[model samples]
Target chain A: MQIYRFEDKKPFMEKLEELLKSGFTSRQLEIYLPHPDHEIEELVEEYWPKSKLKFITLAGGLSGCSAGFAFTIFTSLDWPLITSGKPLVSIPPYIVIAFELTILFGALFSLGGFLLLSRLPSFKQIFHPEEYGNEFVIKILREET
Target chain B: MSHKDTGVVNQEVNAKSAAQVKDQMERDILAAIKKPKPVYWLGLLITITMTLIGAAAWAYQIKTGMGVAGIRNPVGWGVYITDFVFWVGIAHSGTLISAILFLFRARFRNRFNRSAEAMTVFAVMTAGLFPLIHLGRVWFFYWLFPYPTQRLLWVNFRSPLVWDVFAVSTYFTVSAIFWYIGLVPDIAILRRVRTGWQKLAYAFGSLGWKGTFKQWQHYNQIYKYLAALATPLVLSVHSVVSWDFAMGIIPGWHTTIFAPYFVAGAIFSGMAMVFTLVIPMRKFFRLEKYITVDDFEKAAKLLLFTGMIVGYAYIVEFCLAMYSGNPFERDQFIYRAVGDYAFTYWLMIACNVVTPLTLFVRKLRRNIKYLFIISFFVNIGMWLERFNIVVISLAHDFDPYAWGTYTPSIIEVAITVGSFGWFLTWFLLFSKTLPVLPITELKEEAE
Candidate 1:
């Protein structure tokens, strides 16, 4: 494994781009950043695919919307009692619940999705993980052929 | 010095400075968590003591009965309700700073977002308590949720109070998750720097973040998405809270404008609170280099902007009341200005309206000391604004016979004070335990 480290993002990105241009696939190169950088993220995205976390957020949001409405409607209809001379199934107020649930579930699922995608909470890594302080690192996993 | 050689030299110089700055950022932030001065302990002691007093008062109320609280008929909601709204309002600008400004790509947010998010989480936790405290039977709080009860009854879906349950709970959950997400990388840093038990604790807290490209890709996506989600969520929470009153048929409470008005006021009050907490924090932690006066000026501009919106709301409320020729609405507004709580009304106007106007002047807006002093007024004023809305409306309402005043009993006062203690205790602990500034976000500025 070839490990290249830089203290500056400019040099780091230049080195990363240089590797990408020299027939090094993203699969063979692992990048580590002390902080999330837009330029590096974009450069990585060029070789690697876009993150799939958005799908999880969308799915979670849709599910939450349906659940919110279904829960409110089903519960209201179960009793069949109405107050304030209003309709039995109130869509207006339920929309508020649905909207809130959309954000709530979307946020939570995004976090879960992030953890899952990132392979977080790894017991091994937690106890004994690789530590890099304030460096942009790119480790070449293997040379092609 | 040839041009090509000078360019190379500049690049080298820039790289060296960036490296130095990155190191400096980490060291400065980590140093804050290392030691506590006597004043830190003193502040902690006072807040803990206050929290205990508040808890003791709550215990007394639970034991003695709801009668111990001053809330009675005609004024079924008093300080407790005001506190609920106030604290919830206080939470808004945290999200505004952390989530909304983040979306706007306002870099200044980096200075305040971490502590602001912390404040958001803690404030919501504090606000969540008032509802349970307001409940005469606190144990039956579960009834607020739509659960499978033995009686087969569900909470009223049409009620604003029920909506409040969902809004506030979701606000709490989402803000908490967002806060934790922002902390993960910072926690990883702490885990690396600390020793023994501290490292172990931070290890668990960090969830074994490796700062890999893939991890950061997902992390950035979720952070952006959460900011988008929380922007609307924060606005909706206060609107839903406002509806708790607006949906009512009570003259003063029933108004369509309450939604936007309350939201603007929430942001306004929340901005003041950010100042309230952050100014002293910036001073104590000696974070002047990170949270600069320029950042304060930008935040002050936001404060001024929101304050004007709130002031417009105050005027528009009165104008609408008078224009409608509704005696109850007119009486409510008139009574608010000159009746039992007139002092609070004017105080709110002076604090929320007049105080913020001072910021329009460039010097005052840039003056951190002046901003800090007025934040107290805004905090008090915002609390009173909620008081005027909740109690004043219920006090006079439609009937002359029911016209009565409400004064918060000692128990209620103690609990109200205690809520501040509860919020501060968490914040004080947080300051010592966690990075008060987002170390990762600040590093982005180095490049």
Candidate 2:
């Protein structure tokens, strides 16, 4: 195993790009950053596809919208009592419910998707993991076979 | 030294400086979470005592009955409702800073977003308590939920109260998740730095965030989506709160403009509260380096902008009420200005409208001391604003015979004081426990 660390992002990006150009597959290499950097994200994505968290958010939002409307309409119909002489099913007010649920579920599902994709709450990593302090690190795990 | 040797030395010096900056950023930001001083304990002690007073007052109300509150036949909704609106309004600025400013790519947001979001969660928690307290029984609070019953009765979906239940609960959940997501990486940093139980706690809180490329890729995407999601959610939550009044046939309460008007006022008051909390917090935490005066100036601009909108809303409300050709509405507007609650009405105008105008002056905009003083005024003014809208309208409705005045009983006053205590207690604990500033975001900006 080989490790390279840089204190500055500029030199760090340069080194990563140079290594990539020297024919190291993105999969064979591991990277650590103190903070998220878009430039590094784009560079890594050139080898891998982008994150699929959006689909999860979309699914959560759509279902929430439907469930909101469905629950409100169903319950309204379930009792069939109309006060204020309004319609038994009021779309205007139900729209508010649907809208709120859309955001609530979208946010929640996005968190779950992120955790699943990132493999968070990993017991092994939580108790015992490699630690790096304020460095941009690159680890190459195998020789170029 | 030759030119080539000088160039090599310059590069070394630059690299060393960059490393020092990184170290300083971590040390400065994390320093807030260190062992507290006597002053910190004193503040906590005071807040906790206030919280108990509030709790004890609440217990008194529960035991004595709703009669202990000044809320009676005519002015049924009083200080409790005002507090609900005020606190919920307070939560708005957090969303405005963390989610809305984030979308706009306002760099100033980094300095205040963590605390603002914390305020959002805490304020909403405080706000959520009022409806139950107002419910009198408080035990039947679950009746607000839309569950089936033996008689097959269901909660009125059309009622704005039900909408409020959905809106506020959703706001609380989403705000919390957004806050925790932001904290994960920072907690990971703490996990590395601290030892013993603190390290274990942070490790659990961080969920083992290693700052890997894959983790960040997903983190960035979710954060963006959450921000996008939160912007509308924040607006809608306040709008729903407004609808609780707007849907009513009460003269002052019913207005088409209430949605935008309340939304703007929410942001305005919320911003002032941010200034109120953050100004002292910055001094106490010694975060002047990270949270600079320039950042406060930028946020002041937001407060100024929103304050103008709120002021405009006040004028528009009056003009529309007078021109509305409805005597009830017209009387409601007149009573707001010159009636029993007239003092509160003018105070709201002075604080919400006039005080913020100072920020238009460049000198005053940057003056943190002046901003802090004005923040207190705005907080009081906004609370009075809600009080005027809720109590004034209810105090004097259509029939002159039914009109009645309200003076909050001592119980109501104690509960109000207690609410502040409760909110401050949570905030003080948060400051000592969690990373008050978003260290990861600050590092990103520094880089």
Candidate 3:
């Protein structure tokens, strides 16, 4: 992993565009930044077009909605008690549970996706520059010829 | 080029230097976390003591039963429910500032969102305790959850209390996640700068973020989604809380207007709490440059807006009560204004409605002292507002035979003070331990 440091964003972005234009594969190069940069983000999107993050959140929401409804309905049926003489499968109050669960599961799953996709909890000793949080550093993983 | 044009271009160029802004932000924000002042420790000690008192009060209440806490036949909800709602209200400002304001691209929110979110997490923690305290058997609180039990009795899905169990818990989970997710980058920054134990702790918490573009991109996406998810919660949590009353048959509790009314009041109180916490926090941490007076002015304006909404809710509630020709609702509203609890009702009006009007004056809006004082009044007013709605309504409801006035016992008072102590303890500790300002967000805003 070869790391390059730039004092300003323009050169860093220029170098990023050069690498992308030079046909660097997504796996062969990675850009590290102190914060999100719009230009670099655009370049990354152009190079690596797909991100599975949103799907994770969507899947979690659907699962949560189903689980919320199932839990409420099953529990109500299990008890088999009449509440305010309302229907056994109450939708109005159940919607509250469904809404809460949707958010709860969506957030949890999004965090999970973040951890999984970002390859976090990396206890391995990887090359990380101290100024990575203070300055932009791009690392290029080149294959041996 | 003109001199002014050259000067403007130079300023823009200087601001575009990411290295300088990043370095300065790291130094400024990290300094608050690294340096431990004596006053912070003193504040922590005071809060710990108050928390212990609160714990002791709870222990006494537990041993003696719920009767010791001044909740009786008519006023069964009493101070515990009031504090619960008040703290929950206080929790809303964090989500409002962090999620809602972010969606709106409110730049000033960057300065204070971290602290406000932390406040939300802790305020919810404080609020969670009230239901347990209200429950006579705190140990059996799990019965609220719909677990497969031997008795086959599930929590009633039709009940607002059960909705509260889900709503408050979901709010807490989402708020904590949103707050922690926002802190990841900052935590990674801390891991870089700190030493030994602190570095190890931060490293573990930060999940080994390398500031890679991929990481930030994903982080940014998740943050947006989480913010969007939390926005509705800021409305729904309070609305569901309002339904805890609004769904009831009690005269004051049974009203359609309670949903939006409670939501507005929650934000109003929450904003006041932000001012209450941030004023001294910015001073104590010496973070004047980061949390500028401009931020305070913006927050004050938000306070004014929410306060007026709350004021409007109050007026509308009264008019609706009068116009409905429902003697029960009308009597409850009149009783609130003229009955035994009228002092509290009037005080609520003065604090929530009258005091915030001063913010309309530009000079007063910018005055930190005035803001602080008004915020304090607003906090008291919000608490009183909850009290007026909860206890007063119950105390004066139908069946004059069952109507009764109630007062909080010393134990309940102690617990209330302790809740504040517990909340402040977390805030003070957080100020010392983490970046009070979001360093990355601040850098982005600067750009």
Q: Go through the candidates in order and give each one's C-alpha lDDT.
A: 0.91, 0.90, 0.87
Q: Which 10 consecutive residues of model 1 chain B have the lowest summed lDDT?
A: B1-10
Clashing pairs in 3: none
Off by over 4 Å in 3: A125-133, A143-145, B1-17
- Fnat values, one per model, are 0.84, 0.81, 0.70
* Model 2 lDDT per residue over A33-137, tens place: 989887788886776679999999999999899989999999999889988999999999999999999988898899899999999888886899678888899
- Please, what are the lDDT tens digits per residue for candidate 1 over residues A1-145? 8999887778888888888888787578888999888888888778778999999999999999999999999998999997989999979989999999998899889989999999998888799979878888999999882
Where is model 1 more than 4 Å wrong at Cα?
B1-17
Looking at model 2, the pairs that clash are: none
lDDT of 2 by residue, B258-285 (tens): 9999999999999998999999999988
For candidate 1, lDDT tens digit of each residue in B1-447? 122212322344465666666777788888888789999999999999999999999999999999999989889989999999999999999999999999999988998999889999999999999999999999989888888988999899899999999999999999999999999999999999888999999999999999999999999999999999999999999999999999999989999999999999999999999999999999988888778778888899999999999999999999999998898999899999999999989998999899899998988988899999989999999999999999999999998998889999999999998999999999999999999999888777556
- Model 3 docking tier (incorrect/acceptable/medium/high): medium
The DockQ value obtained for model 2 is 0.78
TM-score (C-alpha, index-matched) for candidate 1: 0.97
For residues B1-447, what per-residue lDDT tens digits would candidate 3 score against the true structure?
122212322354476575765687678778877667787778889999999999999999889888788988888899999999999999999999999999999978988899999999999999999999999888999999988888878899899999999999999999999999999888888888877787888887887777877788888889989999999988999999999999999999999999999999999999999999999988876787677677788899999999999999999999999998899999999999999988999999999899899899988988888999999999999999999999999998889999999999999999999999999999988988889999887776555
**TM-score for each predicted model, relative to the true structure:** 0.97, 0.96, 0.96
User: What is the Å distance of residue B257 in model 1 from its true position?
Assistant: 0.4
Docking class of 1: high
Measured by TM-score, how close is model 3 to the native structure?
0.96
lDDT of 1 at B125: 96
